[model samples]
Structure formats: C-alpha cells, structure tokens
Target: MSQQSVIQIALIEDDEIVRLAISQRLQLAGYDVIECADGESALSLIPTGFPGIVISDVRLPDISGLALLPQLLANNPEMPVILMTGHGDINMAVNALRDGAFDFLEKPFDPDKLIETVGCAIEKRQLQLGANKREEYLQQAQGLDQILIGSSPGMVELRQQLVKIANIDTNVIIYGDTGCGKELVADCLHKVSTRSQGNFVALNCAAIPEALFESELFGHEAGAFTGAIKKRIGKLEYADKGTLFLDEIESMPLNMQIKMLRILQEKLIVRVGGNKSIAIDVRVIAAAKESLKDNQGFRQDLFYRLNVAQLYLPPLRERGEDILLLFEHYVNLANIHAKPLSGLDEKTLLAYGWPGNVRELINVATRFGLDASLTVADILVTKPLASIDSSASELSLAMQTQNFERKVIAEALRTHKGSIIEVMDILDLPRRTLNQKMQKYDLHRADYI
Candidate 1:
C-alpha cells in the first residue's frame, strides 16, 4: 500500500465512529485504507486490480456485506476479505468465513487483533500473488529444453535445428511418425521465431472434411452459402504475420493442396463469396507421417515449396535414451500426488514397443498415475492393439527383488545421463559397491549415456 502502490484495505462500514476508529488503527500500523459508507458504493467503489484486502461490516444499509462478498471476489478471487460482525452475528460471521471471508472481526473491535489480522492477510496475499507471477513468467519464458522435455542427443540436435531456422520465413515441413510431436515441434518453431508475438494457427488436414476444408482454410463472407450467416476468418488470414501449421498435410485434398501452394507463393487469399483479395503474410509449417518427396498423391511443386525447412522428429523408440525421462515427465503431469514410477515400471516402459509413440506413452502414463493399484506392466498387458514382454512380472520373489535392484540402479544411471558420481550420490552408494552392483546387473554406463 503506497501513496499509490498496491492498496491494503477496503473498509465498508456504515457506522462512522467504528469505521474512523478502525481506519486510525490501520493507518497507525502503516497500512492503506479505502472507506465506503455502504455496500452499494463498494460494489463499484473498489477499483479493479486493487490487490488489497476487503474489510466490511456484516450489516449495511443498502446491501449486506454477504451479498457484496461474492461480487468483490468475482473480479479477483484471491482478494482477502475481512468482515466485521456484531455480538449476535457470531454464527453468521463463522458462516461468512466458510463462504470465503478471509477472517471476521466481532464489533467492539480489538485494535491489536485488527492490526495482527491485517498483517497476516497482507502476508498471505503477497505470497499467493508472488507465486502466481512466478508461474506466469515461467510459462512465457521457458525454453525448448523445458517445453520439449528431453536431453538425448536426438532431442538436443532437434532443438538446435529449430533454433537454426526459427527466424527463417521459408515454409517448413516436419516429418515424423504419428504421435511423434510434430505439432509440438512446429509450435516451438513459432514460439522462438521473430513472429512469436503473432498468432500460431494449426489445422489438421486429415480432420476436416473435403467439402468444408476450403471454407475452413479461407473463411466465407456473410450469407455466402447455407448456414453462412456472418463473415468468417480463415486459418491463413488469422495467422497473418505469424505461423500456419498444417498437420497431416498428406491428407489434404488434391484441389485444396493447390490453393495452399498459391497461399504460400502469392501470400494472398480470396474469401468464398467476397471478390476482394486479402493478402496474408504467414509461414507455413506442414507435417506428414511419410515422405512427400516423390509421393503420387501430392503435387511436386507444392511439395518443393513446403520442403524449404525440413524438420525430422525421431520416433520415441529411436530415442531410447529419453524413454524414462519422457515417461516420468508425463506421469508427474498426470498425478501430482503420485509416487515415483517404480523400478519395475521403468523396466516395463523400456521393454515395450510404443506402437502409438509419445501419444500412447501419455495415455499409459495417465492410467498408471491415476490407478494407484496398477503398475506399468499391468496397464501394458491389458492395453489393446499393443504387445509387451511382461516376463519380468512372473519372476520369483527373490528374482523379482534382484531385478528391481538392477532396474533402480539402471534408472538412476539413465536419469543422470550415465554420470557415475551423480548416481552414486543420489543412491547413497560407495564407489566400489556401485561398481559391483552395475557389473552384477550387466548394466553399461555407456549404454545409458
């Protein structure tokens, strides 16, 4: 609460004597105050983004503080509201606390208690606001490493490639197997590029119907066709001065493919029923599962135009080094309260062939996180259309324990990227003991790194 810093208090009391007395106490304690006569004025009195605590009397002339409490919170739910109540209103005050009042002061207010409660409210509000700001900044400022969530050589090289061509205006083509995060890569390209401030519009060529694809790409004018009641914006125009990501570009109809090429080459679009030419300055990022280089279904000229910046996303299997890291990340995201993935779970994750790639990995991790009773091995065995070697689950107790020990050591090694010293410290094992365990487990540090 400055001469104009964040406000500290919003006092709404009809009794002038009590209000003045409370205001004097708060001011003496080095706090700010905003006084209101009744709830009506306060409904719009307190400015938006006040960042202050509200202190209101339960009984007001126009509207009770109870009604205004929700209205006050509607703007900023985090705002701490302290209510004042009379002797007989103790029960009502308690109910108000449950209804989201920060705290309540009984009439015949204690000056010391008032100061103390205000101090505590300020501290709590500051902590919450600080945490919100930190998280908001982290989301905007996170780099590719945090967003992509991997450290394998392939991932490292992939990040480098994105950095290399992020600023380039040429159209890009990303090649990857299904669920390999082509769109994620495209998003990364858009986020890090100079055009980051503009929009990043994505369209899955496979998802849209052939008949609607054109209108979806190039928006229509008002009353252009049946059900076209108003003017609409297309993906290309919406993505102006930004990036346009076309996922599964191979699925785009042949006729639409030609228009996509023209949008890329001419940087212009004409609405479905409008004769005006609309210019679009957008970078196209097309993704495909297979090579479009010599495909009969695609136009060679358009393919060449889109293939300017080729980004190949390695399948999850190809980046074996990142399997545990990726799985652990998704698991953490799904289950905030979930314990760490067990040694057996990690072992199962490695042994299975993720037919659906990263997308499948997320579903498996989500299920593993949500169902506390089920392990990765359990989920894998029951999952449809996928096969896994669950032989590790059938081992004798003694053998299973040994296998778990090996799995834990190997998982630690992988997590540390084959750094023996780091793994040793993390596991609290002496060098000789760690080396002996590694030998018994047939685990190679080179393989992990």
Candidate 2:
C-alpha cells in the first residue's frame, strides 16, 4: 500500500505557503494529509472522516481558531488538537493549552519538533481506540444471544432441537465435555423458551461444597444453621416460575439426589431445618460431561427423570467447517481490542486441533489482539494438529473398524467441502455406510454446501 493510504492527519492553516509546507512535511513523513485553509472547511470534514489529530492556526479568516478547539474536542474527545500561533501570540497559545489543546507550536518552529509532537498525538489516538475496542469485546462476550457461529452439522441440529424444545417445559439433560459450551446451550434454552421473561438461575453442582449444597439449593428458615441469622430463600424459591440450570448435575451426591428427586416429584422444598414445605413451580435444566451409562456415581432413577429430553453437545473437532465461522466472529471481536485487526491464514487455522473447544478459541484470539506483532506460528504453537493417519490406525480392528471407516469418510466430506455423495464416490463406500458415517460424525451436507 502507498504511504498516503496509511496514516491520516488533518491540517487547518490559513497561510497558503505555511499550510502547503506543513502538509508536504506530513506527507513525506508517511501521513495522508487533509488540508483545510480555514475553520469552516475543517468543520465540514469532521462528520465525514474525523482525523486522528488536528493542527489548526490560532488566527483563521472564517472563525476564531481558539473557539474551534473546544468544538472539535467536544465532538471527538479522543482527538488531539495542536495549536499553531505567531511569535507575539505566546500567551494565547498558553491559554489554548490549558483548554485541552495537545500542544502549541509557535510559527517558524523546528521541523523535527513538529514531527515529534504529531507522532505523540497519533500514538495517543491509537491507544484510545484500543481501549474502546476492549470495552466492545466485553459487551459482546456477555451477550446471551443465539448467534450460532458454527458451520458444523451437529451445531445446526443442536440449534434446531433447541427451537422445538424451547417451547415446552420438559426437563432437559445436556451432555458434553468440559469447555464444549454446555452452559451456553443451557442459556440459549432459557432465552428462547416461553418463560424467557422469568429469571434464569444457574448453580454449578460441582463448584459448591457438599456440606452447603443442601442449604444452597433448599434454603433455610431463621435460626436454622450456624450462619442462618435470618430467613434465607433457596434457588428453587427464587427461580419460581422460571428456569433453574443445574450444571454438572452428575457431581450431585446420592443423598442430595434423593432429596432432589423428592422435590421434583412433590414440587415442594423442605428447608434444611424448617418443617414448612414451600411450593415451587420451576423447570430444571441439567448438564453433565459424561453419558448416563458412563456415570458411576449418579443415581439411575434421577438420570431417567432428568433425561426426559436430552441434548448431546459435540466437541469442537467434530464440528468441521464451523471452526471458520467461529474464528471470524472472534477476530471481529478482537479487532475492537487490538490495533490493526489481523485475519487468520489457512495454514494457521488447519495446523491446530483445538483441545479446549470454544473457550480456547476465545483465549487465543484475545492474546493475538494484545500483541499484534505476533505471527500465526507464535500464537498457535502450543496446540499442534493431530495426524489423520494416526487416528485411522488407532481404531479397533473389528466391526468397530466400521465406525473408524465412517469417521474417515465424514472427514473426507469435510475436506471436499461437504459433498456427501461425492465423498462416498471418492471413498468407494456404499451409500448405506456413508449415510451411517455422516450421522455418526454429525456431518450434515447442508451445512457444507
């Protein structure tokens, strides 16, 4: 790119020779100059594309240069304004400085000093923009919207299921590995549900200590436990008529499971030390990393009750092309926090097999923003991509090989950009096996196309 296409600076000066000289100096220093002879012309350009710094002569033909300083600063608080004054107007320049002018340059100033002051102004402007971008990222991160950012078939199906399930009050059990966005799915269910107007209360079953789990879930009356100086309301009572998301439900102890089952059956809760059973109308959304068959500690009866409606969240690697969509979303988010938003090269993206899922994607993107000088290799060196051939041989050599074959076929579909029939033809697999593999790998052709 040309030097003029890069840095943009606005210069407001009345004298023809002086304005041309300064603009030429800036242009030679690798800045795109916007020359405005008077305050009126500069005011007109402000709304279109505001410059990073304003260099205005104190005495202008159209407007008092001093008056324009405050107006420019008011419109763009982050913009730096450097005043240009004649030798006798030193006191005027001093007053302008107190009024928030970045600096004042007396006429016949040194060329090096002018360049140095402008450099400082531009750096300050960039710093301010960086801060604003960080704030925007935090807001987007906290947003609880269904911005489905994956191109994987599993994600598409998961979203479709959510659309249907959100209308009913059936208990949902979401199963997924850690960092697979189980909580995000739970939030989506609550947000899209008919009871969205009601509260969404989430409790991590694994995070709470076993001793306080009962009191935390069921609350207590005044003078019940050691610290129960006043009557305390439980999450169930607090979430009455709303959705209560019980994350990591498999971590719930057997004793608590029995009590939870009783509460689910009776629709009422008995406090830790209180006899009065309070009635509650709440929907439960439970999540666990392990499947029901794999859960050794959880009660089977409770599992059946909660799994009335089930959602199995797939891992990041399982969602093939969806990775790009998520990468784009995160890069845009990072642009707000970083200077000069950078994009991902194909090699960088394809060389890393993300083990930590979506959470890991956010972490890497955040780091890239803070240090723009980093290249793809430096940023993603920790998570090296696993080889496809190694995975293929690791499959059990039996009927289970069929499962492995299907997975390889599904990956072929991903590599070929999701042509199901085309992939089947290329792999020479039967139509039946291809269909089975697609379902097994959660690879939907529609998403690829």
- Using lDDT as the measure, the top candidate is 1
Q: Write the per-residue lDDT of candidate 1 for residues 105-222, one digit (tens) a residue.
A: 7877678877777766675566456445434443454578777866668888999999999988788999999988999999999999999999999999999999999999999999
Cα-based lDDT for every prediction: 0.79, 0.73
- Candidate 1, superposed: residue stretches over 4 Å from native: 1-142, 386-449
Q: What TM-score goes with each of the models?
A: 0.56, 0.53
lDDT of 2 by residue, 1-449 (tens): 44235447889999999999999998888888899999989987876336467899888998877899988888887688888878537578669867888777888889887987787667656545543544454446433322655535787788888888998888999988777898889888898898788889999999999999988999989899788999888898888888999998888988999999888888999887899888998889999888875477888888888888988889776776455446546765777555432122333444456667778767776676666555334555434445222432122233234434545665687678887668878899886456544543334576555
RMSD for all candidates, in order, please: 20.9, 20.8
Which sections of candidate 2 miss by over 4 Å? 1-146, 337-344, 382-449
Model 2 residue 192 distance off true place after TM-score fit, in angstroms: 1.3
Clash count for each candidate, listed in order shown = 0, 2
